[model samples]
Target: MKFFSRLSIQSKLMLMLLAVSIASILVISYVGYTSGKEAILENIYYQITELRNSRARQVQSYFNYVQNHAITLAEDPTVIEATVSFTDSFNQLENEEVSSNMISELWRFYEKEFIPRLQMNVDGNPTVLSYFPKENIARYLQYHYLVKNPYDVDNKSRLDMAQDGSKYSEIHQNFHKFFRSITTRFDYRNLFLVDSETGNIVYSVHKDTGFATSFKDGPYAYSGAANLFETLQNNRERGAFEVIDFTSFRPSYGQPVAFIGSPIFQQSNLVGILLLQLPVNEINRIMTGNFQWKKDGLGKTGETILVGSDYLMRSQSRFLVENPDTYFKELKKQNISDRIIQRIKENNSPILLQEVKTNSIEKALKGEEGLGILDDYRGVSSLVAYAPLKLSDNLDWVILSKIYVSEAFEPIQIFGKRVLVTSAILVPIVTILSLFLSRRLVMPIYRLISGTKKITSGQSNVVVTVPSDDEFCQLAGAFNKMARTIDEEKEALEEQIRKNDALLLKTLPAPIVKRLKQGEEKIADKFPHVTVLSANIVGFDEQCDLMSAEEAVGLLNDIISAFDDAAQRHDVEKISTVGTSYLAASGLFVPRLDRDKAVIELGLEMLRIVRAFSQEKHLKFEIRIGIYSGEVIGGLLGKQKFIYNLIGNTAKVARFLMIVNSVEGKPNSILISQNLYEPLQEFYQFFKMGEIDIPSQGKMAVWLLSDGSHKK
Candidate 1:
């Protein structure tokens, strides 16, 4: 205290202010830098995540849309009708003296109308029709509609006009042309169809969308058939998209694109695949478009970036785009930073991100998904986000985003500098004013603190008071009001929970009901006990021709209602029904080990009612049933419809049993799966039938019930 008396008052004060100001500036700058960096990085991360998810979804949607369209066309009633009509024609061919003259004229018309449209030589000799004879000739000409004239020169000579005994072989050729026109009008770029029975490429789009040569070029078109067959075979088992090389049979457009193939079914029989190719450019755009990179404060020093899980660049430096060709060369030289170089080597998985370079940006490119960093690659630091392009396991190929760390931190460095400068000047003035106000402010603050302490000790109705003219006085009054409001909110919240619990109980089981109350996503695998029952309408095909479409559907609905009522009566959960089939399950709400008995009892009751109704209405119909008891997966399906669904392999087997053992040529009846059979064999009247083959699954021994009743 005595040493301070030697200095002047103003001098001491100014020095004290300066010292405090500098210290404050340093602390403020660091805190601001940290906070700003975190905020900016968080935002960038969010953007990358959104971008990746959006791109993956778009690609999946596009491929799925294309795949579905091809499937629909393959199963089109028109196509089926055409094939059936053609088959009938084949039957007629065996009888009539084939019209050589008129059919020849029609073939000539097909050659003019359809053959020339393919823009390819039939077999390197455009004029040679002799090269095509049996199956190929028939399919290639399926789509033509032409006016016939016996006098036409091309027709006269081409039809073996000299041999008055020549038969007009035009049905095969004319049909081919009609199919081509139908496919063209559909606007499917590269539609290819193979005969499931013959293993032949029956329909191959040969214009710009197909092979450059016609089907008559045996090796050219035949070469693609094997590839298409393999794709279909593989996908049928995986039940999803599978990528294959396209260089052997290239597309007419740019670099060969990816293709998806699906089996076309005639009723339940696999006919062939309907295939389409997706453009490579669309996938490229999504993978590369959303990357972000910005320059640092000093242009000389920039932050490089690498994409993170969110597919946003995570970098401490700016991104500078480089020629991709040169970029590869630089990576080869190992001139890039360790972090970036390492990423390029360890590219694996669908999507991954890693810091491979210390300074230069680099990212791994493994399939379509894997982590890669673009922050710093090859000596130059740039905001780099690397994501892999991945085709979906189920649908389309996907593009994942990976961001560089440098770009993620770009704004942090910029804001940090500004905060440092601002605090340097502001701290001095604030220090001086704070010293003068400290004592004066303390008295009012003390009163506010005491009042706040009382309220915090659960005194909800407590009131606070402080100096009238000070900010502390206003704060104390606001605190008292807030406490009262909290008390009211607590009461309202308790009442809301009571209502929510009741609603939740009605929709889900006890455990799930609790989870719902806690606001959790409904899980699909958590059900402890469940029962499943499957019912299919009898003789569904006969109705298609016997009754009008509306009447057929109405009857189907009526049939489903009887089963639905039985499910309700027996307290079973109705899961879903497909076409004329009805699916239901039980035990998700309450566990009953005797679920098999419940399902069997329900089936018997439903059968009795259906039989009585059929007799009363003089309707000829029967319901086939399959029952199984097992744990089931349960969940909500969609946001809008929100179906509470059950799924499991047990459910699948039950459905299969219904199809396999449904007394195919007799009146419909219930059949139990082998799993269900084991438990209730002694209780039911079932007769062993040999074995039957099912699609995908080879064969299984099945039994028929003499009567629906079964006791446990």
Candidate 2:
């Protein structure tokens, strides 16, 4: 310590400079690198939130449209009449006999076509006993629709009629075209009509196994469509709508599906339930962009997933959809059981089977929305944005948008590496700078001192020169600019004072400005006999919405300028204009003996000016005027922005009268208070209007301007 203190003054200064420069570089470099990383993270989070919110909105809008359309379809006359016809025909088929050939043929079709696809996806053995309908009606329809049908499953709805030789086939052929169009147009998986009285699915657009099956005790007794019908069955009210969330529907070979329905009422009697199968593809399309994840800016490892309240996936998983082998491999590493992964492969979908127990999804299910980093379903560290969806009361689902941590922060890692390299190079350069800076520092000090002395002598446009292009030269250049600025600012200040006085006179009255200049803090005056005419351009605001900014402002300037000119001729003073209303007064700014007559004439002239403007512009504009004569108080308000505004019962009453009960309750009409009407009744045409109980000011009589020739 003693050896360091004994160093020379120049050695101490060099040491101090070298230490500060190196330390500053390290601190600045580290701070900038950290700030850039945070900015990137914030940007990714913002993008995730925006995409997540937009997807949620689209899902909500689709469900809302479906819910409303379900109600409309339930009330349609065609659906109502068809529901009754099919239900009756289906009942009549109960007495008919199903021959052995028809039963064998239908069972053979199931074994040949349906069993192969159903066995591949389901867990247990396929049952032919329980599926064979005990009632001959369902067996008969299934034989023709399922056995004799030539169309594939995708085009089964197009099979308008089958040669079943039954009453139900005739009815099915009559209404099949209309119901099939609904499914195709709205992208619904299937459309159904369930008999409310019998709890039977009387009709189906796709002619699936659920057609003619009873939701009460059929093969699909507890399916999505059945649950929805039971919900409305319990309610039993008009306009009753219900929905069932995604579940393993047996009718679709145990695939995930949802249903929306409304009750069908005919003459106040519950007839049937109108149900539509909600397609899983539409929900997946909205969240995953129809599997075009990279095109939607989700990048390589970014995608959105939907989670139900049970923590099961409601939409397809991006990993499982893209590469099942990789997804199952990661799941095994997370200790997921082999049996569940096998089941996922068989179903070809993770929906309703992939469980999400991560904190990000748990917090979202509880309605806590935000961003976080946590282990996703694949057991990988991920950046996740989560929010609860508001699509329906029956659906308590939440949406999550996520990306892998490594992929999202790759740029941040590169940024830190570059910063470290740049920082290492700067330290040695700072050390070399200290050696040269200490030797030349004394030479620039003497020149700066000479320039400072000249500036203190009150010299304008002073210049300082340093020969080298170093820090000292930059200091000299700044000194020259500062001296010149001081000279220019002095002249600018003198001229600004004169222009301010003139601008103040244009906004406020001259007398108000004079009092403010004379140091009056608060200026107010009350006059006994004043007249105020307040008017509104009736269609001005509506017209502005249809016109552009330039056109609207031009129209307003032309109209207000004409009103100002009319006020000058009538010995009235313009008070203020707000939006669509213009106010003018007489006997307040400068008193006149004809204050009541002059202000009324100003209102009458404004009406004429608006009519002319309407004809010229082909616009629908008219002026409604209210003239009142009474006492008023005018004052100067605001310190920074002085305004000459009037306040009293007279101005308030005049403003309200113009809008409420104008003459004939129409446009281009004028109303005057009794105080002004009493003096001008003999000179102009006036008609009595019954008194109205004005707010804050009791009942006051008013008169409307009549169109008859005046006694002027």
Candidate 3:
């Protein structure tokens, strides 16, 4: 007590300042830490939610594509006519003597060969024939035998006869070709045409155990195939499609399978069903991005899973794909059913085929979309973003994008630790400095405070000059040095930013580049009435082969650069250049009513530019230009090596026009589709070249741009 009473005024002031400084630092640190943590967590949650929604949209688009394809197939004239003809023929033969003999032979084979195989494989289940009456089975067998044998005199081997032009053989061959093409083009597991009236499987691309079988009352009547036919019968809408969940498809040897079926109608009358075996690989690619988690911005512990309303996964699992052994161990640890585990072990099928019950799945199935921290199916703590996906009336699937909570919040945890350590170290240093400064800091403190105020007010050149030979002067000098260094670094950073902006401008349009620099994550736009021009230098490939690598590259660059100058002159946006092909468009980022005119002018200028360059280099160069006017969607693709690209039927048709109409000798041939000609017919002179047949688009009128100088 006596020592405290004898303390000097300076000592008391130092203690007070030290205490106040430490208290302020603690309060500010606590507030900053809490606010920063909350903000980071909120950002992460939003990012995951957006990712989940994006994936859901992609899945929906895939399903829409499948539905549209199925509808188109069902509406095909050949499919409708063939189904009706086949049904009529089968009905007419029902009362024939030959049909009776074929039925008797089939019944004998069924008893001796089919039932034994069915019993051996399906555990002697009586349900195989429970719904099938003997008469119905006999009728179905008769139809199968006739179609398969075609011209068998004696009901012996059902091998195809060498009758090249038999009606039966022609019908069989046409149906086989149609089914094979569909299967190959779409990469489907199988394609089936089921008779609507008889419920018999008429044709299949890959005929397995279920081939030539009746779905109505046959051995496989209780499967998804039967259910799909029933659903189509109940729904008579033209474009309606029915989806079946993944199950052990008997035809594919117990491999997990799903189906999509659309009704085939002939003149508004139900004829048959066009069924496509849904390819799981396509869905997996959409869900997990081909198992490329890192490319998808999902780091080590992140994955996206799809769950159907039945609690089964609709897509493959990352854990299973990356580490099957670890997945098996985890499944066993989670106490999955022995039956499912055994199936997985024996067949090496996806774990998604097994039921998965988790909090996220339960919520999503109940039409809930949210983000939360919960235990996933593997009983691991995870941060999950989940949404309900209503692909169609029959498909009630859910998408879950999840990552380990530890990984999701790892950055926050690290930052919090760093802040805590910094505060702990800084608080003591600040207190010690406060005490020391309070002892001799009067003059230097005033000088530093004045100079710091000026610096904070945007005066980077402020210098604190403390002439005293003490620590205060040294501290002032250090402050001035830091200010100068910060000024230099600021200038350097601005220069780097300028360079980045210029580089970005070269890759993307100016407006899009500005938006991206302002932190726009995604850039995409849909232009309803845009004109796309695709120009390719004819014989460029041959020319490259003849010239040296450097010469070829230099020549290509010069040609593309000339085209770029023409595009800029006409206000047309250059989309991209690949090899010798230059793709440009009008009304893409910026909308203009005269987009077609702009594109035409650009195409003509490009022809002139190429001709001049060819004359200058003494090289024989010819250019073909194709322009099509329609809707298009453009966007930036890929995170690394990103490119701004365009897609749609318009882009495809334009490129096709260029390739199909281009000739080697023609120096400047500009082919325009009917769509483009319709709008510009009055403004430009185009010589009609008659109708040209285009795949998918059918026959269309085409014209050659003759005189671009004439304008209406």
Candidate 4:
């Protein structure tokens, strides 16, 4: 402590400044770093969540279009009539001879060619359908429907039975051509019609082994179409649409497929089901950007994945589609379980094969929408935003948009490093500057100290000199001037003190002014019983109109000044004067036993003062005085332009009696309410003035004081 005390002021200031500057730098750095990082994270999360919502809406809109298309196709009159006729005819068939034997040929073809190939591909086990190649299944199904020779003979035979050019052959041809054109134009995997009553596949654009089989009892009954059939049967509305999630579609050689079906109703009875197989590529295009992720702002590890209620991926993974090597490497780095990796390797696709059970996905499937950081399907920590895709009641899929957490926060990390480096370089520079500033600041102060010491030792003429025009030099000049005028300053200070005291006396009561000068924050007091008096100069406004503005103001000022002097003589507090009305109170600042008598005396004195002024000026003016005695509350009113004011029923009734209900012709009369008259009746003589109504206080008894009458 002694060492610090002995140090020069400049050295101490330099050390203190350096310490404070370093501390401030550290605090600012920490706050800036944390706040900047939080802002970046918040902004990024907002952008990612917004993007996720946009993509989800787009996917929803696409599906809505597909659903409406299916419903429109189902409600077509031609399609509905043909489906109903075919369904009825097939259901009633029992040993009917067909013209071309095309049905028999289709059954034969399914039994011999399509069934053997499917069984062989599945190693003679129906449960091994997942092993079959989708290409082979598509080829078999295509041949049965596209081969024209078998159906050409049937067409010729049916044309011979035409009545008005609307033969069965023409209707069937038109329907086949329409289905082919639709399937090609819309990029549908397959278009099929199912018998609503029997749950059988009545017709399909791509016929396969499942074509001639009942959907409920066929080898491919477990396909998504079976579920679609059941849903359509339950809902017989023509526009009713249902979606079946991706599954091992047996008609497509156990390839992953989804179905959207709308019920075909004819005259309120369900005739058939119109079903469209949704291509996975179409979904992948909508979700993963058609393999152009970079253009879509999904960087290397950013992708949008669709997950179903079963926890399976509904859309193809971007990494798997565009960069399989990178995807595989990440899978290993994330330490995903080998069982799942092996399944991915075997299936050669993650769509409908990979299971994603992250917290975001689970919450989304439960119908909650949110964004957070969680490990995704590949076991990589990522920032994921998820929302449920509410296409219909049957489709329970959640869309997830994600990016790796490390990548998302990379900019923040870079910014922190830069701030740290900048701070490292700035500390020494700040320390050096602080030392220089301390010297500049303390040198002038040292001179001022020397001058002050000299002056303290009776060298009153000593002056400090600093060579710059800054505050230090100004301060030195002020010190010098202060030394030269020390005695005069004392006299001026005394004068200022006297003026301040006078001003304070005018603003507050004597005791309140004393307490306030002693540093009291508030000044207020309640006088349980005090007398309030109000005197108004009658005909003052008319007199002012007849006189010049300045003359009128001067006369009113003189009249008020006279009243103020009279109030002082009676020891009454003048609250304020509002043009032509003078307000004063007694027993407020200092309690008195004879407050009512004091107030009446003050009012009589004011009336006398006004009369003297009127006679001296040769002006006809009268003063009406009203006095009331009751409890009153007094306090300072404002912070600036403050005044000591009194308020209560006593003050209110005094104003009402003096101004509101004063006798117009007898302006020199003093009006006293019953409350005041009863108290001072013996000291002064009064005449009964009858009753006058006062607002808010009801009727009040009034008395007019007789001229110069005293009973004392």
How would you encode candidate 2's per-residue C-alpha lDDT over 483-504 as one tens digit per residue?
A: 6786677457546755777767
Deviation from native of the Cα of residue 659 in model 1, angstroms: 99
What would the TM-scores of all predictions be?
0.35, 0.58, 0.50, 0.52
Each candidate: what lDDT?
0.51, 0.83, 0.75, 0.74
Between candidates 2 and 3, the one scoring higher on TM-score is 2
Model 4 scores what on Cα lDDT?
A: 0.74
Taking every candidate in turn, the Cα RMSD to the unseen true structure, in Å, is 59.6, 47.4, 56.2, 32.2
Runs of candidate 3 exceeding 4 Å displacement: 1-29, 85-170, 236-239, 345-352, 420-712
Residues 1-712, candidate 3: write the lDDT tens digits.
6775687655666667867877787777678777776776677677778778888888888878888888998999987887776555445434434356655565554454445444432323533344223454334533354334554322212232214233444565556666676777787888877888878776666645465567787766888878988899788878778888776565454566788899999888888988898868888887788778888877877788788888887788888778888888988898886666666666555534567788888888898888889898788998889989987777788898888888877777787788788878977887778677775657677777888888678776778888787887789889989878877876787789899887776667777788777887798888898899998988777767778999999988888878887788899998888888889999987889999989998988888878877788777777898888889988888797667788988888888888766852145878888888888888888877778777678999988874344566
Clashing pairs in 4: none
Candidate 1 residue lDDT tens string, 1-712: 6676775444456556666767667776777777777676566555655655665566556556766665666577665544444444433433334345655654564466434532231123333253223332342232121233233422221221112221223333444455556545644335555554444444444422232123333333443434655657555642333433232242231223345566666576665555555443444333444222222121223222223333323222122233344544655576544444343333211122222433211223333433334333345433333344344442212233444455456567667656766766677666666555554456555555676686567555656666575666677777768867866775676678777665554444455556655777655665655667777767665646877888777866776777777877887766776787777777766777777777877877767866776786567767788765565677767764444556666676677777754656235567665566777778887766656664444675666663544544
- Lowest summed lDDT across 10 adjacent residues in model 4 is found at 153-162
Please tell me which predicted candidate would have the highest lDDT against the true structure. Answer: 2
TM-score, structure 3 vs. true: 0.50
In model 3, the worst 10-residue window by lDDT is: 153-162
Pairs that collide in candidate 3 are none
